[model samples]
Target: MDVLPDRAARAEFPVGERQLIMKKLIINHDRLKEARDAFARFHFPVVGGVADSGSISLVMGDSRTGKTFGAKSYLGGFPQRPGERGMIYPALLVEMPASGGYRAILENLADAMSIAHTLRMNNSVLTNNILRGLEFHEVELLIFDEVQDVCDIKNPRLASDFKRLMRKILNLEKASIVCIGLPETYGLLSSDKQLVGRGGLQYAFLHPYSWDSDEERKSFRLLCDQFDEGMPFLNKSSLGATATAERLHWVSQGIIGLLKNFLFIAGSLAINDGSIHVDTTHLAQAYDWIKPPQTSFNPFRDDWSKKPDTVVTTAPLTTHDPFAKRKRSAHAQ
Candidate 1:
């Protein structure tokens, strides 16, 4: 009995797309440079400002714009030049508890430094551990992720308390602290009034292509083209898949998160097929699976975006802060 026309069907076709996601590049390249430049500007000894004057940048953009990676990668670039020390000691990357206070945040910082946090629910010990970790690493900057999970701005009492503690411990005199979170996080940051008064280079806003110029679109596409698995290689994009590749930017909405996932899954499927080249059919499957190639993060509604608009009215994290931080939410989703 004749089986079928296609025989070696189950082979890897788009291996590159399936693995090397575009999101990683955004984090490692596009965003990293942003942080470095911002920090460099503020690192000035006499930038001249207020109590805490340095360039404490806030990258609040649409969700999936690679905010986490953008800020986190800043950790790896150290020694910001000789004699130019970073704020944090050894680099403490903390994730605030969804419903937590100073204690929970300190605990997370300790964990990031790989130090044993003997908090056992003890705030003092937790604080001491973090201090030691920071001192050990001579850390210059403290990075907190999912800061939005910590609170809402409407509550005056909570907001006041949060501000007091942050100033006393984190901001105290002059420590460059970087907060990583969705655009809403910036709202929470500004609600403190005092926090916002310090001044920050606000970004992290995903444009959603609302007013993108042609050059901007072309540049981003060019970057993605470098890694487009449907294409041939760096110099030659979509050598065989050129026709289908044209729509890639439109489908991915220039959002790294969307593009990465689209390529990864579809690329994997193609790779599994072991085809030497991808066809429009593969792009369709990828597009369908990707759902939103051009998805944007509407920070106001939820889940994720830009300069951070008006602060949302909610109480800041107090004694009642919970363990349900952003990671927990991410896990839940």
Candidate 2:
């Protein structure tokens, strides 16, 4: 049963990820393998790192830098060892709400898992059951993206409980956990020594590829080429050898996650207007579309001067108006 695209997508899932597919955007097979190998080694990022071991991790980056994308890729490839078959290993991925905590985290998982039983209010028992279900599913790994929520743990003890849940993974019949979020994730780890010390599970961090690097640009171009077939209309090819990956580098602030939304918006526009391909104009519009609203401006301030000059104040006078000539004709006659 494949999930097909439709308008109800908004009603069904969160934004950005409703129709997201890593294969649709990046050739991360090699990068993906590096993470898996690192996990096997117990290296800082791979094994001994906070990212790999902390049951809850905070993976933060500019909007689109592949933080979520990388987690999805890992989830897709989790527990790849042989004899891993007949394993009903369940892999559950859920977003941490903008403001989140251990309770929200548990509830989201419980709901996503669609467990038959009720999770007792703030009960750790159900949380453990959630962990046990993964074991029953033979799921070897657990990945929770949008981890910035770990910071939402206000119950001073909530953080400890979150860590405790992670430690339980070690107690599982067969399971591994990966928590990803923004830089705040590291802060969460620094506060808890015991949580950071567990077999020193590795923290795998995926950095944004430098679109300016000749090498990096080459890869991005290759991705452009790979996607050309699907994006038959987005003639990213025209930009070709000269395509300024740097522009994307600057705009996306070098986050692989950001590129997906930026490009998708551009591509969707081209599709709608029946454009032959994606061009600079399409890119510009996409830039606006993908930009999250600024946090600094206060609508209540009533300070017009504080608003960005770029904010539109009036529709530009248009030549295409059907009534423009009629007014002139009346005057001329």
Candidate 3:
């Protein structure tokens, strides 16, 4: 088996078509900082665990809440101090396939490590090699994203295999596992007895705030101020203004993803219109594009803005499948 590939040959591969590269910016805001702090607290304790037993943690949240980003950020900052074992990676991050068996999982791990592909190897052999590879790399923390794929009830075998594989991987000294997924991941992971050890903790990534809570409202106002201060608008954003903040809260439902998207869309619109201010009109235009369900409490509407106090409070819309049939119908896709 050609486990050691020619690095020069791989480098000869040509680059693909040019992509419409949008600037990828990381906003170091309060919410993301909180998540990172929580991860740090979770990580240190697991490092002291026994060699034979590893800690399993669930980082569950609604989609687009920056769970993956936070996890990656934490792992990216892992200690790289060189020692007798060479460059030590205190953590490593990998993503799960949408659907596949144990073979697919092995392949993904091999791909991550840039190991030469070897399909002829048996499953047990491949698994052993991967374990050795992780040990060789000295990865103490193993992070998996989109882990809800293993929760498919229709294919119990895949889920069962996932648990078995995780148990094996965690056997490494001071090795800890982190899984990031939507809220359903908590329920799915809890249902599996093999996975439900009471030793681990479950953390929600996106914590939505209530409009009525004074502390929450203050925190949101501060967040709005930070975002507004960072934008390049000449007329200075009033997103932190009490009325504007109220309207913004209604529009975003306090979801960080929606709130950030609204700001970006509105800011872009303002830039395109040769204006420096993001007012109600720009926000309204952005809301039209966001096309949140046409509820009675549409804050973007002119009438609603005039009587912002009348905006009815509703539960945060986290469960709505953005890719569902209704979404396609609404978007004319």
Worst 10 residues of 3 by lDDT: 14-23
Candidate 2 per-residue lDDT over residues 1-333, each given as its tens digit: 133343333223332342253226454433444444533443134444432332333344433455565556555644333344333534556665554566776776666555445544545677777776665555545666655455445545666766776677655535556666665576676566665565443465655555545676676655444444334342333432433344554444444444555567766665556565666677667666544344233222324344343322111111123122111010010
Tens digits of per-residue lDDT for model 1, 1-333: 112112123122244533443224332334445555544444433465432333344655555566565555555555323224333344446677865565666666676666676535576666656555555555556666676656556545545554554554454334556666666666677656666555544434533321145555555655455445323222222512432333554444455565566665555555566555454566666655433233332222222223123222111222234221221011011
Residue range with the least summed lDDT across 10 consecutive positions in model 2: 324-333
TM-score of 1: 0.64
Q: Which one wins on lDDT?
A: 3
What's the lDDT for all of these models?
0.48, 0.50, 0.66
Local error of candidate 2 at 246, Å?
2.3
lDDT of 3 by residue, 1-333 (tens): 012223233222222100000013356766688768766656665456522237777887766677877887786677556758655666767888875677888888766655555878988888888788777767777778888876567778888888888878866645678778788788777776655563454555556545767788888887787667555554567898877887787666666776877788887776667665678888888876765354443456666434333332232333334543222111010
User: Which candidate would rank higher by lDDT, 1 or 3?
Assistant: 3
- Per-residue lDDT, model 3, residue 52, is 24
As for TM-score, the candidate ahead, 1 or 3, is 3
Lowest lDDT 10-mer window, candidate 1? 324-333
Residue 84 Cα positional deviation in candidate 3, in Å, after optimal superposition: 5.6
TM-score of each: 0.64, 0.61, 0.78
Segments of candidate 1 deviating more than 4 angstroms: 1-32, 39-55, 79-90, 99-102, 119-121, 128-136, 153-162, 199-211, 229-246, 292-333
